[model samples]
Target: MGTLTSILVLSFLIFFHELGHFLAARFFGVHVEVFSIGFGKKVFSKVVGNTQYCLSLIPLGGYVQMKGQDDMDPTKVSYDQDSYNTKAPWKRIIILFAGPFANFLLAFLLFIAVGSMGVNKYAPIIGKISENSPAFEAGIQENDRIVMINGVLIEAWEDVSTHIQESVGKLELKIERAGSVQTLIITPKINEYQNMFGEIKQKKMIGIAPSGKMIEVSYSADKVIGFAYDQTIKATTLILTSLQKLVEGVVSPKELGGIISIVQVTSEASEAGIVALFALTALISVNLGVLNLLPIPALDGGHIMFNAYELITKKAPSERVLTSMTTAGWLLLLSLMALSIFNDIYRLTNGN
Candidate 1:
């Protein structure tokens, strides 16, 4: 059941992505030949208007087949008035960008829904303080709720960490213990810690941990929109940063996971409840959006890059160059997919 739910969620995301391209193409008077929810041999299909909507065998990804705009064969061209090849370069770029933009828009909407449903956050109550640490030396005790730091009112554990990291010299912390409020002055020291990617990094810290207590935070209507926007931007930035770290070797490729890992995590999220499922779905949607914008052949971003060149130079790329680059892009993508699947299997077998 969980696996089925994962497949359905993935399909919905793919459908939404392709719909963006289909709608944009139609808007610009371009003929769409096929709107498929997956790659390879078609298992189900229907002709709707001029477009053939399909459910293909492979559920990994999907595509929009606009007339004269074939990723599989870049050399294919139709210069008819209604064909994609006849569209202006700028228009073509917009058509190419619409797919990823849809994913981001969907993610933003999902985040807003999650916020309305309530977001769980760790309460700013200290669980433990390291021995001889700044917080401990300042007489901070377990179960003491952090009220404010450096005049900034604390709402959650995340706020506490942010204030500590950004503090200049001494931090003025206001805490509530036993229903009584008290103030303490503490100076954070530079400490080395292992981050999420297992990289050692130095940062300012007061050496305090959250008490594992959670609070559900619901935003007002006006604030929910802002919350959604912030969450969407943060998710996008995090994915981009992770990619940068991967390229820089700060994160190992061995940690990469493929469709199997996505399904597993999503399945678990489904079992955890609606809020968890929504949060994971939003994150994955943003991930899809960011990845589809990579400047590689066989992706929306790569096609946009080609179109932008033509827009600037007043000439399209040569057939030979287009075909070669597209082929290389497909090869690179296939190799990465294979590697990620291998890593996923290895982790499962070794119990990582």
Candidate 2:
């Protein structure tokens, strides 16, 4: 049941992402050759109007193939009327940008609804301190309110978490104690522990515990909308930063995950009820949106980059160049996928 639910939720995200491109292409008067809900051999398909819509065997990725997408094939040209290439640069840009934009919009809606329900916040106040731990050595007293870490202002307990997890040893923290603000330096000690995912992680520990507070705060409609928008952007930035670190070899491959990990996480969130599930859904949705926007060939961001170049240089990149880049992108993506799956299998076998 949990696996089925996870698949359904994932399919929903994929459907909306493809729908964004399909709608945008149609709106721009572009002829869509294929609108698929999944990849590989078509399981079910129907030709409607000018488009062949399909649900393929593999439920991974879907695509919107527009006329003149590869090249200005005179043979496939029905009419120049609203062909993708014939559109003005700005229109073309918007159509290409719409897919990711739609993902962002979906994330924003999810966040707004979640926020309106009043998010449970973990206070900055430290509840417990472990003796002989990093926090104790750093003089992080109990009841101290963490204000900032390494000069970055701390909002919720998550802020502290992000800082602590990502930051290297020795970080300066600002805390408010007895109405006086003081600075303390702490080094997060690396501790090998089995994480919730049952994988061993060299977790950074400050040894300070958090206390949660549930408070309903009403915000104006605009604020709710803005909060959603900001959250999506912030989440994207964090994902990108993590990716950069992984690429730079600062993070371990064990941190990477495949479908099994996602299902595990989804099941856990589902067990936490509707609010937690919604929040998790929004997080994953935003992550998907951001990943799709990476400036790699075969992605929307790559297409957008080409369009931008075309607009600036007044000449489209050669089809051969696009094809080569996309092929390479596929190879790189497949390699990463294989690595993640291998990691998953190894962990499972080792009882990680």
Candidate 3:
């Protein structure tokens, strides 16, 4: 039941993503040749008008196949009036960008729903401190409010987390207690924490926790949209920052996980409840949207990059160049996928 539910949820997200491309292409009068919910041989299929709708054996992800869109000529070989290649650069750019935009939109909607119910907001006040931990040894106490970390003003509990993750051995913290502010220096303990998804992460821990507060947030029309947008931006920013850290080796690739990890997360979230499930889905959707926006080949961003070049130079890359670059992109993506899978297997087997 859990496995099926996971697959279904994944399919829904993929469908949501593909729907964007299909709608955008149709809006621009481009013919869609195929809309498939998976890869490999089709288990079931039906043709409607000019489009072939298919459910393939693999349920990992789905895609939109438009007329005149292929590996050789990304715009596809088409002289037809409604061919994708015949579209203006701007239109093509929109079609390429819409898929990720759809995912982002889905995340924003999910966040709005979550916010309407209420959100658990954590105060900067310390609630608990581990014995002999950095915060404890530094004379930090429960009820002390964190004001700053390493000289940066701390506005929320998340700011504390953000600073801690970037810190090395020692950290300087500013705390307010009994109407007096004090600065203390302490070194964090290197520890491993297992996340809700059962992924183990190695982080620098100060052993302080926030005072949890439940805020009944019934937002106004404008506030709801603002909150959703802010949350979406925050999630995207986190992903991008992590990517930067990964490149700098501040984060290890061993922390990475692929489809198997996502399946486990989805199954666990579904078992937990609707809020957990949707929250997980929303986070994943944001990741998908942001990751696709990276200027990597074989992705929507790469297509947009080409369109930009075309608009400037008035000529698309030769078919051979497009095929070669796209093939390289596929190879790079596959390699990364393999690495993520390997990390997942290692972490699971080693009890990480």
- Best by lDDT, which number? 1
Error of 1 at 225 (Å): 1.7
For model 3, residues 132-210, the per-residue Cα lDDT tens digits are: 8878888999899989989898766877898998987688999999999999998888899986434588888989888
Better of 2 and 3 by TM-score: 3
Question: Tens-digit lDDT track for model 1 on 1-352?
Answer: 8999899889999988888988999999999999899889999999988889899999878988888878889988998999998999999988888988999999999999999999999999999889999888899999999999899888889889888888899999999999999999999999999988888899998889999999988888999999999999999999999999999998899988899999999999999999999999999999998999999999888999999999999999999999999999999999999999999999999998
Preferred candidate (lDDT higher): 1 or 2: 1
TM-score of each: 0.96, 0.73, 0.77
Better by TM-score, candidate 2 or 1:
1
Clashes of each: 0, 1, 2
TM-score of 2: 0.73
lDDT (Cα atoms) of all candidates against the true structure? 0.92, 0.79, 0.85
| Top TM-score prediction, candidate number | 1
Q: What is the lDDT of residue 84 in candidate 1?
A: 98
- Give candidate 1's TM-score: 0.96
Stretches off by above 4 angstroms in model 3 are 72-76, 123-125, 128-222
Q: Which segments of model 2 are wrong by more than 4 Å?
A: 70-79, 129-209, 212-223
Please provide, for model 2 over 1-352, each residue's C-alpha lDDT reduced to its tens digit, 9 standing for 90 to 100.
7677777777778888878878888887888888888778999999998789899997766777787665322133233775777777777778877887777778888889887876777877787898999899888887889999999988678778889988976889999999999999888887888744344778788888885543344346768887787778888877887887778877788788887777778888888776677778888888888877888776777777777888999997886787777778778778888888888888889888
